[model samples]
Target: MTATIHSLPRKAEPSLEPLMTLVADGLNSVNTVILDRMQSRIPLIPALAGHLIAGGGKRLRPMLTLASAALLEYGGNRHHKLAATVEFIHTATLLHDDVVDGSDMRRGKKAANIIFGNPATVLVGDFLFTRAFELMVEDGSLKVLRILSNASSVISEGEVDQLTAQRQIETSEERYLSIINAKTAALFAAACRIAAVVAERPEADEMALDAYGRNLGIAFQLADDAIDYDSDAAEMGKDRGDDFREGKMTLPVILAYARGDAEERKFWEAAIIGHRTSDADLDHAIALIGRHDAVEATRERARHYAARAVDAIAHFPKSDAKAAMIEAAQFAVARRY
Candidate 1:
């Protein structure tokens, strides 16, 4: 008798829809605050800021704030304004980042700096930061104010550190993690910690949420770095190989360079130092990354952090909010764009 063979079903890819659905109403309120606060007497201020604010970002940072509040079952409207503040801080950073990177595209559209000019973009970024502070002050929570303000400062310091590391192939994994922890993860931690403050949750709870956000942020950044070199990856809004061309010294480059042979090392040295910048050069770089499995290695690193993010909230009683948070961390590692 011949036996019939059965194939196992593939696991479905993780998605952000559950988290988005959980925070939908709260996010709507946050959007209202964002639109109202972003308005200004100076037409250019609103116009330039609106260009990026209306851009197709997932608004992940603020959504984390809202979701954290929901997880705590917090019944207050204060988080809406605070969530908007989180978004302002994030948007300000993006505006400045595009200008610093000399990017041509943001959220699949022309970057604010390209359309409004670098000076205007920078000023608008400053305007958003001021608005963020105003919102924090209006909330009348010194603790909240401190957390967010410190995050803003850390983000700036991280940006400066990354600028110093740019084109420096000597940038170590430890140093790169330090930079991302401050620049990218700091705001995520702040966003989640403030939810505990609003909910009157204990310090331990606050720390737990902070850990979750921080790890998730690192995972998100790592996945993004891997995508920049992954040939089969979908377009991620920004120009492909922007990190390579800019010599950002991301994890993939670090791994590939470390694992490369002598001839490959020579090619990487030339690429990182601005000697190789053509499309052909980028193709070769991608090929080298593939040969070393650097992209997969970076993604594996992301999965590690994503698992930590999930465990950070594991003690919480099972609820829709908790499940959504767990899935969000999985999505961070699994996302291609």
Candidate 2:
């Protein structure tokens, strides 16, 4: 009797390389627009903005715009400036978020506010927002203008809602989702939706892309939340345990709190209310999270949204663009840093 050798199939690692390659040319144009539009006669405007912009961000939002255009086979250059606009809006939010969170580090370096002072950092963020609007008006589409502007407003509202919920241990999962949907996912949705507008695709197609971006954004944020507490995870650039110190009720914290026993609940209540915030407290917090397997639970939630994101674009015909997008969603869940 002859026995055949058996081999198991290796799991394919998800990656953004395909998406990046697919959008390379369009991304170059968007980068040019970003570099040009971020400049100003006032030295501080460009100086402060450049600090964060040149920082090692993945530029995922603008890339999403380019990828959406690729998926639609849009042959126009209109998306270049619009993609830059989405990036400006996103950068502005990051600057302002760092200030609001009192963050000292961002993207593996000192935050802009730390180097430039909060006032200058804030003004530069405003300048970026102004540049974003200028790009929007130059795009000459009322629908595009409305979508991005509304997203900007929604992001502000979400930030405010999150602030109100900060250190409030009673924050429910429903409310947390609502906050991220606006603060993070709104720009993601707008970024992709505008591509459909530029392509002149029908409303249904636009909605499909919007759903894809929104769910992907949520998945990405959830993964970030899990990384913050994952003991074996790589450095995330931002200060580790910043969320715990800030008393931000991320999903992992929410889940851990919800599942904690009476003793564990007391520790969480104190931690969220700003009582327990030492390095040891963070370690204990991580311990409690591990005891309940909350980080993995958070990752599971991310996988759910990532699957929804993939399904959102299922009706689109098979192409490199579609396959790249599906992999991007998979990457969102698989990424640790």
Candidate 3:
């Protein structure tokens, strides 16, 4: 089946710059806490942790924590520690993920696992994970501990589910979404909701922020999945087709397989399920994805989620923080990287 390729123009969205500007002071505090907490008696631990943490990404997860706090007009220094904790959790997960995925790149450079070795990388990840919990305990908020700890468990479960579905072309959309929601959205929700909790906001406000972050997380992952097929390795800060190469059942692959003919199905089985893919087969897979409009479909799905994210926070009063949060949701789908 041939799908006519229609060019989809990129949508304009807010740069994270404005959000960074608004939260610059808070973010600085978060960074200071992150560095202080990452220190260890053993040199290799800090060295390896620094390699990934200092390598530089958007720091969006922690930024969400900061923004959510600011939106609630929080005045205490506690949110800084909480934001740092969120980043540590995120970074720790990335370290373990690189080892598990056998990935060679992260944030546009050699992965920590490759540089430090998998054993060292994994141990450092554990160290960071422990440090994150330490910070949570220092905050002395059982509610905060419960939310983040639960997110950590859900994230592990999501990764396991993804592992179980690896190369399984027959994986259903429901199953795929369940994995994304648990693996990706859960933390986003936790990060955002914790801000409201720290501020002692009403349950409704906490739920609204949670909804905003969860939907935005789903949109972010969907866009990332589409980008794997549409972009080059450098652009993505990792190898292109990493998902396909890893035999992960991302949305593009799922959508294409669902819409493909019997012959195409056989190709998916060999290239994905049977793990017999060659570089040439990867090229063909890209073609098949385009032919089925899988990337476009995935982008539209992301847009839908982004919209829902905006709606989730509709009741909040208009302010720079609120506007930035809404735009962050839009940027989830708008960003190419």
Candidate 4:
């Protein structure tokens, strides 16, 4: 069925001034460390690696890593390395994702696939993946490696599953959520849990952190999907309606299709499943979907995850870091182009 939020005008930017300040500082350290290490690699690797490393993003994963650690009162500066490693792993995945999806743009610039071609993007992504492994080894923590390795495996497998399920009208929520866990939630869970694993926190604490990351990731992805309904190319940095244009069956379309009238359903079936959608057709589809509550339902789901994320960090013992991590969940739900 349709949901509600997108029918309204944009809300005020979520109050993240305090969290932004902390998240920004953490991001700065993460960017420096990640860029420096990426450049240290062999030339071809560095050029490709640096290309994405220098690209602008919210840098949420590294922020999650460092914030979780600080909440646990980690004393060593080694969290910086893990934070950079997190970014490397994230950037590498994006490289592969663009190539696999044949995307032309990301973050307001040509995707590596568009600029360097698919082959270079794939190979460079592989290089960065290897580099992340090498750096993880330096940490000398089997626990860290275990977390990251598992996440990487899941991410790869999840991507394959999503590709396999493409244009799949029969996809269920259980199946969709499973894919989300693999493609999106895995790394988020790992990022938060890695900090706890490193800090020697209680088992309960680690589990809670894992929950925080998983829910945060889910919220972020859901919000991302919501934006696709009317995403502004200049602001969101990608073509608006890219997901719909690709026939990806994101939450909005899925919800709308399920609840649509026969004519509405036929419109989607022909334009989407039948592979005949044009830009004008896609815009019409977005407006039709909005006539229902599809986008609002998706936002509500995102807010649910955001709330769960906040609850997950509740037991972390209050600190600026802890508060900011909680606030990040809200930020994920509320961000706009």
Model 3 lDDT tens row, 1-337: 2111222223455577768888899999999998998999999999999999999878899999999998888888788999999999999999999999999999999999999999999999999999999999999999999999999999999989999999787899899999999999988999999999999999999999999889889989999999999999878999887888888889999999999999998888887864656778888999999999999999988888887777777788889998788778767787788
All candidates: TM-score: 0.96, 0.96, 0.95, 0.92
**lDDT tens digits, residues 120-224, model 1?**
999999999999999999999999999999999999999999999999988999999999998999999899999999999999999999999999999899999
lDDT at position 209, candidate 2: 98
Per-residue lDDT tens digits of candidate 4, residues 102-141? 7888888888888778888888887778878887998989
Q: Model 1: how far is 335 from its true place, Å? A: 0.7
lDDT of 3: 0.89
Model 4 has a clash total of: 8
Worst 10 residues of 3 by lDDT: 1-10
Off by over 4 Å in 4: 1-12, 15-17, 23-26, 40-42
In angstroms, give how far residue 8 of model 3 lies from its true place: 17
Candidate 1 accuracy as lDDT: 0.90
Off by over 4 Å in 2: 1-11, 231-234
